[model samples]
Target: MSGATGAAPSDNPQDGERGELSIPSRRPRRLRTTPAMRNFTAETDLNPRSFVLPMFVADGIAEPKPISSLPGVVQHTTDSLLRAVEEALAAGVGSIDLFGVPQEQTKDALGSAGIDPHGVLNRALADVRQRFGDDIVLMADTCLDEFTDHGHCGVLGQDRYGNQIVDNDATLTQYADMAVAQARAGAHVVSPSGMMDGQVRVIREALDAAGYADVSIMAYSAKYASAFYGPFREAVGSSLVGDRKTYQQDPRNRRESLLETELDVAEGADFVMVKPAMPYLDVLREVAAASPVPVAAYQVSGEYAMISAAAANGWIDGDAAILESLTSIRRAGADIVLTYWATHAAKLLRQGR
Candidate 1:
C-alpha cells in the first residue's frame, strides 16, 4: 500500500478542505511563556512588609520550649525572644504580635497577669521596644485566655439561671485595662482578640484616657470559633475547656461578620481582621470590601500545622504551598496577614523576587 493513500484526513474538516492548519489568533499563553513575563503580568504581588509574625513569650522559662503540635514553632524565653525579634527584623517582616504564656501556677480566674506591669507579655513588650526602638511595629494580643486559668477570653459570671457566662461589660473593663497596660509596655498596637461586643470602643477610650492616643487598636472583628485554633492552644498553653462559640462569630454566618466589622470600624479599630484565613476567605473578602479601615487575615495554628504536616510527609511542596496560601489571602483582600510562617514566608518572597 502507498503511504500517501493510507494517510489520515485533517482533524478539522475545514483544514482538509483548504489544505491548511488551524491556529489560535489570541494566545494568553504568550504572557505565561516565560517566568519574567509571568512576574511582570502578575496581578497580585506579595511583599515581606505585609507579614506579621505571631510569637509566644513564656514567663519564667529557663529555655525555649518547643510546641509539639506546631513543629518548628516554640515558646521563647525572654533571651530567645529578643534573638527571634532580631531575625524577624532582619527578614523585613512588617510586625510581630506578642502572646504571653504565663506559668500554670500564675493563672487565675481574673487573668490579672495580663494587666500587671510585670506581666510576661508586658515585660516582653518593654524588652523588645528597648532593643528595637520602633524598628518594627510591635503588637500585643490583648486577650485574657492565655492568662486566665478558666481559659475563657473574659471574666466569668453566673446568669440568673445559674449558668456560668462571660460577663460582657465586666470583661470590657478588663480589656480596657489590658489595652492601657499593653500601651504602657511599648506596644504600637493593642489587638483585642476576645471578640467581645463594644470592645473596640471601650479599648480606644481607655487607651486615649491613658495618654496612649497614638496606640492603634487592631480588632479581631470577624474571628470565628474555629477548631483550626487547635495548635494555637498549644502555642499559648491555653486552659480552655469549652468552646468560644458564645462570643466568637459562627463559622456558618457571613452577615454577622459584616456587622461586626462595621461596628469595629465605627468604634475606632485601626485595623480589622478575619481569623483562620483559609477557612474564612469569603468572609474576609466581604469584610474587606465593606470596611473603610485596613483589613487583616490570620492563618491560624491549624492551617499552619496541616501544611507543615503534609510537607513533612513529602506530599506537597512546602515553600510553594506557603506562598500560595499567603497569596490566596492577599488576593482575597487582606492588607496584612498574621501567620506563624511570617518570617519564613518573608524570606521566601525575597528569594522569589
Candidate 2:
C-alpha cells in the first residue's frame, strides 16, 4: 500500500509494514485552521463596552477645528462635540472622556475656570447628561493644564531657594474642587490626569463630602512624561513651555509603575490608568496585575498620529493597524482603552471583524 502522498510502499516489512509515517502527537495548528476556530480560541477579545473615546471640546469655537498632527481628530465646538457623542453612542462606544479647551482669554495661573460650574467642561457634562440620560458613561478630565495659562497640570510656586515648581498639594486642592464640580455637572467618572500625588484620595474625599460618593475616580497613576503627548498639547491648545518630568512618571522606569499603581489604589482610585499605552505595555501589564480595580490605558495622540500618517502614505493598512494596536493594548490586560479610534473600532467589533 502507498501512503496518502502516493509514496511507493517500503519493500522491507520492518519499514512500517503499511509504509505509513508516524503521526505527530501535538498539532497546535489544528486550532488555527479556520477563522471560526481562531475566533473561538482568542484569549483576548476587544469589546465595544471596553472602549472610551477621548474628546476635545474647544470652549468658544463656532465649528470643529481639525488637529493637523492628529489626523481625523479635531477640537470640537459644543454643538460638534454633542454630535460626536451621539455618533459615538450609535457606534456603541462605552464612554466619552471629555477634555475642555477654554479660549486663551479664559486661562489663568490658577485655572479657576476648571472649578466653575458654567465652565466649558462642566457645561458639556450637563449637556451630555441631558441628551444621553445615562445611556452612555460620561467622563470628565479633572486637570488644570488645559485651563491654565502656564499649561502645567497644577499651580506653580517657588521653593525656599526660589526655584519655581508645581505645587503638588495645591494641585490636589484644585483636583478636589474640580471633582466636585464635575460630579455636580453629571460626570459619571472624573479622571484626574495631573499625576499629582494623593490626588485620588483628595478627590475621593471631596466627592464623598459633596454627597457624590457614587462618582468614580480614574487616576492617571503611571502617566509618563512622553513625547507622545505633543499632538495632545496642540489639540488642547496648551501653552506649556517646559516638560512635565517634575510630575509625570519617567518613561525609563518599570517597577515605578507598579508603585504608582499601588499608591493610586491605596489612595482610593476606582480605576488606575497608564498613559501612552503602546509605548508602555510592559508598565500597563505590571500595573494591571497589581491593581485591584479596573486598569485603563490611553492610546495617546502620538500613537494615533503615527498610525494615521503611515496609512496616509500607503505604508500600512490603516484599519488593520488600528485594530491590531487596540488588540495589543487589550491583550496587555487593559480593562478599558481610551483611544481616538474608539468609535470606529467599536463599529468593527459589532460587525465581527
Candidate 3:
C-alpha cells in the first residue's frame, strides 16, 4: 500500500523503494495544458493594427484580374481597389501599401508614369484619401519597376562595354520625383523598394523642397534579391529579362543588412523594412534590434502562394498556418508585417481562432 490509505501499491520494486519514483519538480507542460493558460503565457501576440495589406491596382482594367500565381490575390481596378480598401479598413487593417500596374503601352525607359500626377497610382491614392479621409494609412510604392518597360527598378544605361546597367544616380532622381508626386496625391507614406543608393536622402530632400515634409518615408533597407519575389512579378505584370543583383542585397550577407539599415536611418527614413520575412527573419530580428525607427517585414507573394497552395490541397490548415506564420514574423521582432493575408488574418485574430 502507498502512503495514502486509498492509493494502490506501486507496480515496480524501485517505485516502492523510492516513494513512487519521485516526480519532476518542474513541468513545462503545466502552462501548456490548457488553451487559456497557453494564451496567457504567449510571449508574442498579433494585432490587426500591426498588419499592412499590399494591394495592386491596375490601369485599363474594368474588373479585378486574378493573379494566377497568387491564388486569392488580384490586380484591382480603381473601383474594386477602393472596395478592397474599405474591406481591409473594416477588418481593422492598419494600412494599405499600393502598387500600380499601368497599361503596357504606358511603360517607358524612364518610367515617367511613376512621377506623373495623373498616373494610375496617383489617381488611386487621391481617390482613397478623399474617400477615407485619414481613417486608414495610405502608403504608395515609390518604385519604377511597374512603370518601366524593362521591369527594372531604375533607368537603364549602357557602360563602356555596352552592357546595360541600372543608373543608380538617375534612379534616385526619379525616386525623388515620384516621392513628391505621391505626397502631392495624399499618400501618407511613400515606400521606396528600389534598393538604390542615396534614394532615401534624395527623396527626403525632394519631399521637403516640394512642401511635403509631413509625408513619411518607408525604406526597403534590407530588401534581398530572393526567389520569393516570383509570384510578385506576376502580380505586378513585370517584364524583366534579368535580375536586380546589383541593387538588392545579396541573401548570403548578414552584416550587409545592418549597413543598409544604418544608411537608411542616416538618410532620413522614417521606417525600415526587410523583404521575404520568413526567409530573412534572422536579418529582420537583427535589423529590428538595431533600428531606431519602426521595423517592418514583408511576407512577400511567394510566401503567401506557398502556404495558400498547400492549404488548398488539404495538406495544411490554412487558418492556423496563416496565424502561425504572422505570429512568427511578429516574434522575429517586426513591428509591422506587410502581407497579402492581412485582412483574412485580422478576421481570424478577431475571432480568436
Candidate 4:
C-alpha cells in the first residue's frame, strides 16, 4: 500500500506528467499573479466605443455653462457642441447622443418646433454632421419632452370632461415626422425615447418613405418613468406641472419591460434600450438577453447627478466610481451605454483602464 501496491500511474493527462505536481496552495490566484495575466483572463472588457456621450446644446449660450444638478456636465452652444464632439473623438468616444435646449417661449402645447427643420435640435444636428462628416455616429434623441411646453413625451389631449391624457395615435404621427426630420438632418441614428406604442414601426416606415432608409432606429423600448430624471428636466428646461404616470410604466412592473422589448423588436427596432441603467440592471440584463438586435442602456441624468454630488462632497473617489459604474453597466450585458460620463470614461479607458 505504501510503495509497490500504490495505484499505477494513470493514462490521464494530469497523471502522465513527468514533472512533480506543482499545484499552488492558493489555487486560481496563480493565474492572477500579474497584471498581464489578469487582463488576459478578464471575461468582460469595456472600451470607449461602448460608451455613447449625451450632450445638451443650448440655442444661445456662447460659453459652456455647467449644469447645476450634474457637476462637470454642461449645456453647450452650437459652436461648443461641435468642439465637444471633437474632444470626444479625440478621447476615443465613437458615439454621441444630442439633445437641444429650446427657449421657454419656443416650447408649446403641441411641441411643433420638435419637427421644424430650423429648430434648435435640427440645426445643431446639421452643424455637427457637416463638421464631423460621418467620422463619428451622430445620434438624435427623438422625443418631444424637451421641446414640449408641458414636458410630456408626446402631445397631450383632453377627455370629454377636459381632463388631460396622452393621445397615442396622435403622438405616433408626430414621432414619425420627428424621425424623418432627424434623419434628413443627418443623424446616423434616431433614438425614439417617447415610449409610444408602435413608435418604431411608424418611424421606420416614415424614414423609409422619406428616402432615409439608411438611418438606424434606436428604440427606448423599456424606458420606465422614473424619478431619476429630476436633473434632466432642469437640463432641458422642462415646464412640466405634473408627472408622466399615465403614459410611463409603473416601477412595480418588471415583466412589462420584456413585453415592451418584444413589441419593439417586432416593430423592426434596430436596437432596444432600458433607461436609468444603474437601478434597472436586471431589466437591462433581461432585455439584452432576449433582444435580437444590439442592446443599449441609458445612465440617465439623475444617476449622474447623485454620483457627482456625492463625489464632490468628498464622499467618494469620482474617477474611480465613474469607471466602476460604467464597467458594471457593460458587465450587465449592455452592448452600448448612453452616459453623461462617456468622454471622461473614454479618457480613462484610453489611458489603460
Put down candidate 1 lDDT per residue, 133-233, tens digits, no spaces: 88999999999999999999999998899999999999999999999999999999999999999999999999999899999999999999898999999
Local distance difference test, each candidate: 0.93, 0.92, 0.94, 0.89
lDDT of 1: 0.93
Supply candidate 1's per-residue lDDT for 20: 70
Q: Which run of 10 residues does model 3 get worst, by summed lDDT?
A: 10-19
lDDT order of candidates, best first?
3, 1, 2, 4
RMSD of each: 3.2, 3.8, 3.2, 6.8
Model 4 is weakest, by summed lDDT over 10 consecutive residues, at 8-17
- TM of each candidate vs. truth: 0.94, 0.93, 0.94, 0.91
* Regions of model 2 farther than 4 Å from truth: 1-23
Model 3: per-residue lDDT, tens digit, 78-109?
88998999999999999999999999999999
Residue 237 CA displacement from its true place in model 3, Å:
0.8
Better structure of 1 and 4 per TM-score: 1
Q: Model 2 residue 59 lDDT?
A: 81
Q: After superposition, how far is residue 255 of candidate 2 from its true place, in Å?
A: 1.2
Better of 2 and 3 by TM-score: 3
